[model samples]
Target: MNLDTPIEYLKGVGQQKAELLKKELGVYTFNDLLQHFPFRYVDRTRFYKIREVSADMPSVQVIGRVLSKEIIGEKQSRRLVAQLKDDTGVLELVWFQGIRWADKLVQPGAVFIVFGKPTEFNGRFSISHPELELYNPSAVKQGNLTLQPVYNSTEKLKQSFLDTKSLQRLQASALEIVGRSIQETIPDYLRSKHRLLNKADAIQQIHFPQNPNSLEAARHRLKFEELFFIQLKLLRNKLLRTGKFRGLLFGQVGEKFNAFYSDKLPFDLTNAQKKVLKEIRQDTQKGIQMNRLLQGDVGSGKTVVALMSMLLAIDNGFQTCMMAPTEILAKQHYASLEKMMGQGFINMALLCGSTPKKERRIIHQALQDGSLNILVGTHALIEDEVQFKNLGLAVIDEQHRFGVEQRAKLWRKNSVPPHVLVMTATPIPRTLAMTLYGDLDISVINELPAGRKPIKTIHLFESQRLRMFGFMRQEIAKGRQVYIVYPLIKESEKLDLLYLEAGIEAISREFPLPQYRISIVHGKLKAADKDFEMQRFVKGETQIMVATTVIEVGVNVPNASVMIIENAERFGLSQLHQLRGRVGRGAEQSYCVLMSGNKLSREARIRLQTMVKTNDGFEISETDLQLRGPGNIEGTQQSGVLDLKLADLAHDQHILQEARDAVIRIFEDDPELNTDKNVLLKEYFLRKTPAISWNKIS
Candidate 1:
């Protein structure tokens, strides 16, 4: 049978069985049937004598003859007790709610090989309902027994008579077909160099490992191939992007950059930002389409670096557009940029979704006629009707929020594709950054701006709420605003929203005087209402704003100095950091109070400790990567920046770098993967990309 052949077309698989297999195991094709690897294996080679069985051991197999068997207890909670004896000692076997089955399986004076964990009950050794196999005296002679493969199966499948044994039969059938049809993908030299196994051997060993060493070798080969092909794909995309798209050469606008650095700013820009800006300036002037990622901690002067890039664009006689995810953020950028550039020198317009028709018409006309040099907006900037005069630079904020298509849409705004600069306050672990943005050049603003004090982060239990309240009161009395954030958007049937609503009500009660204003915002509130509350907080009308994660992204209030996240254990590390970022925006010594619930897990404690020790987003992100792995760096939807299978963005960073280096070497030598050895790599990419249609060039 071919790889694509239906399972029913194979021998012994009937229509009913095939449908059941498809529903239960997702095994529709011969290939799918062959690739269902076992989750674990039992080393049947080691057998423990009945007398040698221990209570603490995970599992043991023992041979013994049944001495007695009896059913006990009521109908609802019936149990069977069987006393088994070997030459050395006796052991009790118990089964709950399966007395009839147990009675039939263990007949008195019958020898059986049983496997399970042994426990001490009433100072006697006992096994609770062990898996049994009938012993045969004729097959007694043996060395080490073969390991038994344990495939993952559901109870429903077992009830339908499609248990592990049934699945194994189907697997045996597919193995015969696969043995004939499948060809080896890895070449010999590289296999020998990496000390890897052949594809067929690897697949077989993965499903039914002969030993632990064999399993390790098999895993290494498979994982390496998976990562290698992914790297090859990304490198190819990078090559195509860099070679084909030409960028406007904004030669060393160091004069403009230095002017802002040397004189204009109130506080000195960090060395990291300056270094990244230099890199960006060099890339923009090289006449190659610069696709660079500017990663930084919150309030690290990324905005200033982005502003310098825009200035470079303007100095080179081209217009720039900085797009934020939200209208509030767009307005924030517009205001900030206006203040930085001082109005009319570079005509900036705000063309958001909420922009009035008349104003939008004016903005559209201004954009088309080259009157507008800078435009800040949401997705409204990428609308088909919104044309640009000369869009040389496109700076996207919070890059993870936009997908390849969304970014590509903006790229299409300019005929030649504007040099893209994606910015993120969310510090992605470096390894993840490589896999996620392998095609883009990365520049990290690793240092905070000068004189910016690190946010003092503290963790507290639920019982310390009163102490936290008192601390907040002191902070507010010192003329600082406080932010109390909750995890929920609205009340749910499953989750209690008592903490959220209670926090709001409690804060309102604390500040009962009319002079003190308290605002409440959450996902349940209307967008306008949320915005209004945020505006009040930003304008200093509200001394405190109790809200949810909806305000985590870009609801900036520089004056707000205290952030208290309730039940911080429920939120991820990166998220808590983002919430913490809401404070520490201004020069005041900001503080973050992480109120956690009882029963903190090891990982949870590590997360809290990481926050307490460091304010570096990059470091926090790295710690997060180590803790959670790279499962949701780009989020769940396909629209997120990075989505990968098998590759752990956090743990596999080193591998990613190695793979990237390998790709570079391959390209330097061959340019295209046309060599005989690289054919498998190409084929591997072809096989994997169909799911994402990543192979299709558009």
Candidate 2:
């Protein structure tokens, strides 16, 4: 049988078992079963005495005789209790489930093997629902395995009598059926040079390891292979894009750009901004398509860089567009840019879902006639009715919120394709950026703007509500606005909204409406209503804006100086950082109060402490990566993050770096992979191309 043989064709896996495997573990073929490596290994070479079994022991195995069995309790409390003796001592074995079935096999003086965790009750040790096995001296002597592999199993699989033991049997059977016949995926030369185990042996040893050393070798081989292919794929795409596409040339910084920079620029560009602008200029001048990711902290001047880049396009007589995920952010960008554009003879328009039909028509006409130099909007910009005259550069804000297809639509707007620049305020950990955005050249705005005071972060318990409220009153008295952010947990959205409404009522009582002028906003609010509330807050018509996480993205209000986050512990570290970013935009010293309950988990405490300690986004991102794995990071869900089965991005960075370097070396040897030594690499990719790859677009 081949590796692709249906799993049901195996010796013992019937259709029933095969379906269970597929549904439970996504294992449908022999190869899949083989690749489903064990999470941990247990030594089975020795057995412990019953007398030596302590309550503190993780697990223990003992060969004993079932001396007595009795059905204890009744109904839901029913249990099967038995006394087992192993020459040294008598031990209590109890089964809270399957009493009828358990009482039969375990009878008087029947020799059996028992294994489970030992727990003490009333100073007596007992095993609850221990795994029972028939003792066989001949089978014990015949078995050559020194260690046993433990695999993850679902409750449904266990219910079908297909537990970890059954999974282990299937793995062993898979190896036996396909043993040496398991074809290698990695090239032999690379494996040999790297001292990696062959694919076949690695698969076998990973399932049933002979020793710890061999197991480690097998893990290193598999992890390297997984990460190696990914890096190769991303790097290859990057090289292909850079070499293949000829971008629109914005050769020189012209009039509009010069006018805005020298005359109307608010503050001198930070060195970080100048470096990134230089990179863009260099990329644009080379006539190669630019697909670059610009990462900055929340308050970093990325918008300014984007504006300057767009101005370069305008100077070269080309149109530009910037797409934000939401209308609020779109309008915010439009307003900010309008103020920045000032007296410059630059024509810009904003288009969104809420744009009036007349304005949309005017926008369409301006865009089609080449009068509009820049268009900033939401998904409405990509609508069929709205088209750019000569699209030269497209800047996608919070790029992860848009799908590959959406971004592709923008790319297709121009025949030669504009230089695509993706801007994200979410600081990506270096390891994540390596794997997720490796195809795009990354430039980070590591430095915050000068003269901006760091947000004063404080952690407080719920009992300090009076203090928090009084502090809010003090801030409000100083003519500064306040933002009270409440987390809208998805599982209980309605409950959270109700809690938010209750909070609004309480705040009104405390501050007294008419005089307080608090604006309430949440996900449930209608778009028009939410916009009205947001506008009210932004225009200073409201003293406090109470909202959910909806405002976490791009609601820019320089006057809002204090941010109060309720249930701060419920928010992720990156999320807390983002919410805190809302306040510190102004020159005034701002404060972020993280209000949480009394009880806090160790991880939650660390997250709060990290927030209170530093204002560096990269540092906070690293801590967030440690506290909550790479999965929950905002944009990485679809960026090859889930495909990782074994490699820990937080800890296996060394292996990832090694794999990346190896890919580079391969490219250096034969860029096209046409050489005899690299043909296997191409073959490997041909057999395992992903359904959708991020390398295709920004």
Q: What number of clashing residue pairs does each candidate have, in the order they appear?
A: 0, 0
lDDT tens digits, residues 617-659, model 2? Answer: 9999999888778888887787554488777788789999989
RMSD of each: 3.2, 3.3
Error of 1 at 541 (Å): 1.7
Give per-residue lDDT, candidate 2, residue 180. Answer: 80
Off by over 4 Å in 2: 42-58, 62-91, 97-113, 132-147, 489-498, 690-698
lDDT of 1 by residue, 486-569 (tens): 887556688544467767777778778686888888877887888888888889998988888887877777789999998888
Q: Which stretches of candidate 1 lie over 4 Å from their true place?
A: 11-13, 17-26, 42-45, 48-60, 63-67, 84-91, 108-111, 117-128, 135-159, 162-165, 252-263, 634-647, 650-654, 683-698
Candidate 1 pairs with clashing backbones: none
Candidate 1: C-alpha lDDT: 0.80
Model 1 alpha-carbon miss at residue 637, Å: 5.2
The candidate that wins on lDDT is 2
- Model 2 clash tally? 0
